[model samples]
Target: MLLPKQMTRVLIVGSRNALKDTIEVLYQLEAAHLIDFSAEEEGFSLGAPLPESSVASQRLLKLRSLEKDMGIDDEDVSGQMETGQIEMDLASTIDGLEAEITGAIESKNKINLRINELEADKAVLQSFQALPLDLELYHDYDSLKVFTGKVRGDPSALVKAAAPQSEVFLSGNGDFAAVFVNTAQADEAQKALVQVGYTEVPAPAGPGSPQKHVAKIDEELEALRSSMKEAVDKLDELKDKHSTFVKAADEHLSIIVEKAETPLRIGTTEYTFAMDAWVPTSEMPKVEKAIAEKLGNRAHLESLEVMSRMEPHGHDEEGEEHAPAKVEEIPVKLENGKTAKKFEFMSGMLSTPKYREIDPTSAMMITLPIFFGLMVGDIGYGIPFMLLGLIGLKKCVSDEWKTISTLLFFGGIWATVFGVFLFGEAYGIHFAEQAHDLSWSSLLGVQLPHELVLGGFEIPLGIYSKLHSVKQILYMSVWIGIAHLFIGFCIGFYNKSIRYGMKHAIIEKISWLMILVGGALLLLFVVDFMILGKDVALTDIRMLVAAVLLVIGIGMAYKGEGSGAILELPGLMGNIISYTRLAAIGMSKAGLALAFNTIAFEVMWGHDFHVLGSNSGDIVMLIAALGIFLVGHLTIFILAIISAGLHSLRLHYVEFFMKFYEGGGVEFKPLKVIRKYTIEKNGVSE
Candidate 1:
C-alpha cells in the first residue's frame, strides 16, 4: 500500500506480418507501457504505419472541420453511438454533412456581408439627409465641383471669400455644408473647407431623395437579416441531426490513427519486428498467456527483468559488465486504496514518487485533514463544510474539485469531533457558562451541562478554550510536529535502506532521527527549567542524554552529509517552531469570533432582549443584532476555508515532506483508447 506497483521489463518480438495483431493484443490488455525504439539496434529500422492510416486520417480531418463549422461542444454530444453503426454511416454522412454545411455557411457569410454594406450606405445617406440635398444633385456636375460633408463650424463665409461665384448651402445645424464651385476655383474652395475641419461623406450612387434611399436600404437590410436567421437555423438543425455521428466518428478515427502509429515506436526488418515495453509484474503471466494464445508461434514474449526497489550497483571493470549500456527508468504506478487515491492529486502537485520510494499519498491522506481540522475546529462551520463537500463530490467530475471535496469531507468530520470534545464551542461561543465572558448558557438564560454521561461514562464536552488554552495548544502542536516528522524520517530510512543499502540509510537518515529525538528532550528540559522555574541543572539526566545524542547525531550527520549538516542545526528547530501556526490560526479565528459575539450579544442585551418571548427589547434591535451576527460569522466561515485549507497543505508540503520526499518520476501510462461517445458491440479491429 505504501509503494508503487512493481514493474517488469518485457521484450516482444514477432514477424512483421503479425505486427498489427500484436498491437491490438497489447492495447486490449492495457498493461503495456511501450518504450520507443532507439533505431540504434543493428540491422533494424522503425516500422511503417499500416495502409488504413491514410484513409482514416483524411476522414477524421473532414469530420473535425464539420465539427468546427457547426460549433459543436462536448456537451452537444447527447448519446452514445455503436461502433458498428458509426462505421456503416460515417462515409455517406460525412459527405452529405460537408456539402450541406458548406452551402449553409456560404449563404450565411454572403448575407452578413450584404447587411454590413447596406448599413454603411444607410449611414452615409442619413448624413446627406441633414444637408437638404438629393443623392444625384450632389454629384454628376460638369463645370461644378461639389464638396458635401460635415464641418466643425460654418464654412459659408470662407467658401464665399475663396470663390465669389461658388454657392455655399449651410444646413440649419451649420455643421453640414455643400459647396459648388467652377472647376477652375475648386482647389481654392477646397482649401477654405479644410480650414474649418471638413470631413467628406461620399454621396451614394443613386437617383432619389436622401431619405428615400435610406428607407430603401433599411428594407433591404431587414430582408438580409431574415435570410441570415434562416441560414443560422438551418445549420443548427443539421448540427442537431448529425452531432452524435460526428463525435463518435472522430473518436473511432482517432483510435485507429493512434493504433496505426504504434508501429513507429517499434523496430522492424523486412520480415520481423521487435517491441520493448514495461508491464506490472503481477500482470506478466496474464499478458504472456494472452499473447501466446492470440498470436500463436508468430509472436514471442520474453521477460527481461523484474525491477526491485533496491537500485543496481556495480564496481568499474575492464571486462564486459553485467549492467546494460542504458538504464531505462521504471515508470511508477501508485497503489492506493480508494480513500487514499483522492489525495494523490496533492502529492502529484509536487511530483510523482520514484519507483524506489514509498508512495506518500497514504500518509498525506491520514494527516492533511487532521491538520485542517485542528486549525478550524468548529462545529458551526464543520457541518456546513461537510454538506457542501458531499454535494460537490456528487456533482463534480473534474479531479481538482473532487480532491477539494475529499479534503472538506474528511476535514469537516475531524473538525466537528474536535469542536464537540476538545473545544466545546460553536461559532466561537462556549456551550457552558463562562466566568466573565459571554456564552450560550449565559446568553440564553439556561443552564448548559459541561459534560455528557452515557452508560455511566462521563465525556467532557469542552476541555479547553482556544483563546485561554494557547500555552497547551502551542505545546501540543510542537509534539504533533515531532511525531509527524518522526514518521517521515522512518519512511526515509526504509527508502534509503532499499535504494542504497542499510549502511547509507543509517548514516544519512538515522543521524537526523537522533537530532530530532535530542531536540524533543531538550524542549521538555527547557520548559521545566525556564518556563516553570524549576531548579533543574545542566547535570540533569534528560539534559545529559539530550546533549550526548546531539553530539553523536551531529557527528554522524557531518560524516554522512558533510558540512551542510552542521549548518542545518538551527534550521531543524525552525521547522519544529513552524507548527505553532496551527495554534496561532485557530486562536486568530477564535478572537474574531469572540469580538463578533461580544458586539452582537451587547447590542441585544443593551436593548433588554434576553429570550425569544421577551417583551423588553424592540424587534428592530433584535433583527439588527442577528444581522451583525450572521454576516460576521459568514465572513469567518469563508476565511476558515482559505486559511485552514492552505496552511494545512503548506505544513505537509514545506515542512513534513521536505524531510523525506524526492519525487520526480515518470507516471505509468499504458497504450489504450477511452471511448466516451462510442461503444463497440463487435470487438476492436484485428
Candidate 2:
C-alpha cells in the first residue's frame, strides 16, 4: 500500500515498571522482520500524545527492559531472543504477566523461609552426634626399651602373667625387677632375665582419675542429640505448613522489586498500559489482529507508515494531494488470480544480485544461466551440478536461499543443453572415436572434406576438421555479448522511463543503443579484422557503417548535455568492451577442455606405450589416461565456474547497477510473535 513518505510517531504507555517489559516485546517483533530500530528519547514525552515513532525501536526497548527488570541475565535474554519466537505485544504481555507474578512470589517466600529454618535445625542435630569420646588410655615406658623390642616389666603385667598360675600381688609404682615371683620356674628364669622395669603409678587420687568427668561428658552428648533432633522435627512440620508462602514470596519479589524501581509510561499518548510495535510488513495485519484479540479494547493498533526516498512535496502546488508512499513491494505478477506463488517456489532463487536496481532479478536470471553453461559446458560436469543443486533444494530449510537454489537448478539444465550442442551430439559427431580411427568416415552427419592433420600427426578429417575450429564458438560468444549488452541497455531505458518520463527513456535508450552497437561493431569488424590481418567480409563492411552511424547518433544525443559527455566517451567505450569478457570466458572454457584432453592423453599415454610391453602397458596406459583426464578436467571445471560466476556477478553489479539502482531502502519490519520450529497457538508463552 502507498502512504506518505514521512517519519511516523509512536506512543507507548505505562510506568517504568512496564516500560522495560514493553520495550522487550516490541524489539523482538521488529528484529524478526529484519528491521533496524534505534531508541530516541529526546523528543519523547509522557503527557502529550504522539504517533509511535518506530515499532522496531519500541519492541527493542521493551526487550531490554524485560531483561533488566526480570533479573534475567543479559546472555540469557539474548539467547531467548535468538532462539525464541518473536511476537508483537509480547513485551506488554510479559510485563503484565510479570506484574501478577509478584503476588505469587510473596506467598512462595513464606514457604522458603520455613524450609530454611527446618534445614538449620537439622544441621544442629547432626552436630551433636559427632561429639568426641571422653576416655583416654595411657602408658609410660623408656624409649630405648620400646625401640629394642624389649618390654619393661610393670606390676600390672606381673599380676596378669601370674594370675593364670598362682595368686600374686604387685604395687602400682613398684619396679617389677625388685619383686621376686614365688614360682618354681623363677630360679631358672632369673639366671637369664635382664633387669627391664616399668611401673603403673597410681595418682594421689588413686583410681578415680578423670573417670567421673568422662561419664558426665558422655551423658551430656546423648542429651544434646535428643534435644536437637526434637527441634529439627518441629521445624520440619512448620515448614510444611508455610511452604506455599515461601513460593509466593519468591515469585512476588522477582516481579515487583524491579517494577517499583523503573516506571513505564506511554510516549506522548493517552494509550497507557499498551503500545504498538513494528514487524515485517508482510505480517503486519496478522500481528495487529492478534494484538486486538489478545488485549481486546485495551490495545490500539495502526498500520505501518514506512519511509521512502522520494520526497512528498517534490513539486509543491496549491491544494495538490500528496503522493502516497509505502514500503517498496517486490515486483510480482500473478496469473489466474493465484498470486503466482513465487514465495515458496523462488525462495532461494531470489538472490540479491550485486547491483539490483540496474540489472534487477530478470537480468540475473538470464545472465547466470549463460555463465553456468559456459563453465559447466560438458554433460558430465552438468550432471553433477544439477544433482548438487537439486539436493540443496530438497535438504535446505532456510527460505532465504531457496531462490538461489532454484536458479542453479535451471542453470544446470542450460549447461547440459549447451554441452550437448558443443559436442555436436545432436548431429551424431563423434570426434572422440575419429581421433583414434583415421579411417572413420562421416562425423555428425558430415562427410570428411579434407585430410585434417596437426603437428605432423595424421588425424581424421571428418571429426578433426570441424572440432578443431573455435571460430564458430567465438562468433557465437560475440553475438551473445551483443544481445546481453542490448538487454542491459533496455533495462536501463525501462528504469529511466518509469522514474522520469517517455522523453528521457527514448533519449537514454537511443544514446545507449548507439553506443553499444557502434562499440561492438568496431571491435568485431574494424579492429578484429584490420589489426589481426583477417579480411573483412562484405557484410562486415556494412556493419562497420552501421557502427559509424551509431557513433554519430551518440554524439547527437549528448550534444545539448555538455562537453563532459564527449569526455566520457572513453569510459563508455571501456564499458562496452567489458562485455567482451563474457565471450572470452566462453571461448576459454572450450579451449581449456580441449587442451586438457589432448595433453593428458598424449604425454601420459605415449610414455606408457614406449616403455612397457604391449599387454601390460595397455592397462597402465588406461589407468594413467583416466586419472589425468578426470583430474585435469575437474580442475578446469572448478576454475571455469569460479571465473564465470565471479566475473558475471561483477558485470551485473558494477556495469549494470551503475546505470540505475539506488539501494538504501529501509526494510519493512512489523511487530509479531515469532516462534522457531513451531507456531505459537496462544500467542504467548505459558
Candidate 3:
C-alpha cells in the first residue's frame, strides 16, 4: 500500500445538447459534498468565438429542452400534471426532475401573459373610475325639461333646484336641474326642496342644452364598466388554469430529461448515477444494491475494474524524446471501518494548497472538542461533551461533519481521563480533603512541595499548600509544561513512523523524543546534585547512559543543514520546553478556583459591620463570597481552556507536524442529496 500519491483528474463527456445539463448536475453534486473537482477547459474546442455565459443559462436551456420533449404547456392539464407528478415521483423514473422543473418553470410564458392581461384590465377599470363628470349643464331651459317639479323661489328670482328623474345622473355640480311652472308653484317647490335638503336654481330660456351629450356619455360609461368586470374575471380564470398546466408540464419534462441524458462515462466505464451524478468507487455492496433496486440493472449497471495507467513515450534523434506524463497513484488501505491512505490529508493539501484545500467540516471535528475539553477538563464537562458529540455524529447530514463528530467522541474520552488525574483520584487514590494541605505526600511519587529557607534554617513548602501561592502555582506550571512537551514528542514519533519510512522517520521524527528525555534527565540530575549535595553515584550509571544516548540521537536526527552551534541548540531546547504550557494552563485553572474560594470566605467574612451585624451582614458576606468564587473561577476556567486548546493545537500543528505530517490529502466526497442539520431515510431528496 506504499506508493507515491497522485492528484485525481476527472473527465466528463456528453452530447453537445447535454452540455448545459451536465454543468448543472455537476454544480449540484459539488454543492452537496466537500469533495473538490474542476472541469478542464482545454479538453474541448469551441467551434466559433462566443461570449462566456452563466452556467445558470445553460441549465435553463437544458430544462427548456426537456420540457419541449415532454410536450409541456401552461394551459394544458395533461402536461402540467405530468411534470408535477414526475417531480413528486419517488421512483427512479423521476431522477433528474429538479433540473427539469427548474428549467420548465423558468421557460414558461403563461404566467407572465396572465399577469399582463390582469394589468390591462385593471388599467381600463381605473381609467373609467377616474373620468370627470360634466358640470354647468343645468341652465334654466335644460332644467325645466329634465324635471317635472316646481322651483324653490319666485319665477323671476334664481334659486337652486333638484332633478328627480334619473338614477344614472347626480343632481350635484349643476349636472341636472329642476324646473318650476309659476310663482305659486315655486312655493310648493320650496316645500319639496326643504324636505329633500336641496336649493333650486332659476330656469333659463334656451332650446340648445349641453346636458344632452353628458347623459349620452354616462350611458356609454355604464356599458364599459360591465365589460371591464367580465374581462377581469376571465383573466383570473386564465391565470389559475395556466399555473395548473405549468406545474403539470414541469413534471413530465423532468422525466423526459432524465431519460435523455445518460449516466456520465469515462472511456468504457459508466459512472454510477445518483442525484444528478455519476459516482466513482462502488465497493460498498449496499450502494450497488440500492442502485439496482432503484434503477434496473439494464439501465444503471455497476462494473468493477482497475483503471489503466498512461503510457510512457520516447523522443526523436533531433532532440530529447517526449515522455508520457506518469500518473502517481495512492494505494488505499482499510482502517477503522473506512478506507484511508497514508498522509492523505497532507497530500491533498499540498496538491491544492489554496482556499479549497482546507476542509472546514473536518477541522471543526478535530479542533472544537480539543478546545472544549481543554477548557472544561473535568468528568462533569466530559459527560456533556460526549453526549453532544454523539448526537452530532448520529444526526449530521454532511459526511464531512459526521467525520468530525467521530473525532469529538474520542477526544471527550481523553479529556475525561485527564480530568480524573487532576481530581487526584487516580487508581482509587482520593485527595479531596487534603488537596489544600501541602503537607500531604505525593500521589504516585510525583513531588507536590517546594522549599523555602530563612535565617539559615530550611523550610518545606508545598505547591498546593497556600490558598493562593504564586510561587507554588509557577512550579506546577513548569511541571505541566514538562509533561506536555513529553506528550508532543511521543506524538511526533508515532506520526512520522507511520507516514514516512524509518530512514527519514528516525532522523526527523525522533528528534523531539531525544530532546525531551535527555533534557528531563539532565534537569533532574542537576537538581538532585545541587539540593542533596551528593555526587553522581555509580548506581545511577544507567540514567547517565540513557541521557548520553538521547543527546547523541538528537544530534544524529537533526533536520536542518545548519552547522551545530551552541546558540541553535538552546533555541531547539526552548521549543521543546514550550509544550509545558498545556499542563500549566490546566493547573492554573484549578489553582485559580481554589484561590477565589479562599479570598471570598476570608476577606468577605472577616469584615464586621455592627450597624448591619444581625447575622444579616454575615449572610450577605456569604452571598458575596459565593458570587466572587463563581465569577473568579469562571473567568479563570475560560482563560485556561483558551490557553490549553491553543497550546495543544500549536503543539500538534508546529511541533508534532514538524516531525511528520504533510497534510494535503483530498477528501472523498460522494454524490448524494444531503440535508443540513437533519437526517433522511433511504437517501431521498427534499
Q: Which 10 successive residues of model 1 have the least lDDT summed?
A: 313-322
Residue 559 lDDT (model 1): 82
173: Cα error in model 1, Å? 3.4
Tens-digit per-residue lDDT, 468-585, candidate 3: 4334434454454555455544544444444333543456546555666666666667656775577877457646865786777666554422244234457656665564454455
Q: Candidate 1, overall lDDT? A: 0.88
lDDT of candidates 1 onward, in order: 0.88, 0.46, 0.42
Clashes of 2: 86
Q: Kindly indicate the candidate among 2 and 3 with the higher lDDT.
A: 2
Candidate 2 per-residue lDDT over residues 1-686, each given as its tens digit: 11211233233334433344444455444422322222244554443211233443444454444343344421321112211223443445545544544433444455456555545544333222222211121123222111111225533344335432233222233322222333554443333234343332222111332445445445655665565565555444434432332223223232233232222223433334434333434545555565455445444555546433233333222212256474224322111112222222331133322111332544456576666665455555666667766887888867545544554566677766665555432112233434442221332234633444679976442221224445554556556656766776776666555544556556656676777777666666665667577777757775867767677767655752346556766766666557667656655665666666666555444534322233343667768877877887778657755776567667766665555444433333333333322332334454
Deviation (Å) of 485 in candidate 2 = 2.1
Candidate 1, residues 1-686: lDDT per residue as tens digits?
79899999999999999999999999999999999999899999999998889899999999999999999999889988888788888788889889999999999999999899889888887777887667788777899898888899999899889988899888788888889999899999999999999999766787879888888888999889998999999999999888988999999999989999899999999999999999999999999999999999999999999998886862122211257567778899999998999899999999999999999999999999899888889888888888878998899999999999999999998889888888988999988987756678976789888999988989999888999989999999999999998898899999888877787788888999999999999999999999889899889999999999989999888888878888988988888999999999999999999889778866766634334344445688778889999999999988988999999999888888888888998899988889999997663443
Off by over 4 Å in 3: 1-84, 87-421, 424-502, 510-516, 530-534, 537-547, 558-572, 602-604, 607-623, 670-686
Model 1 residue 223 lDDT score: 88
Could you tell me every candidate's TM-score relative to the true structure? 0.95, 0.49, 0.45
Residue 389 accuracy (lDDT) in model 2: 67
Predicted structure 3, TM vs. truth: 0.45
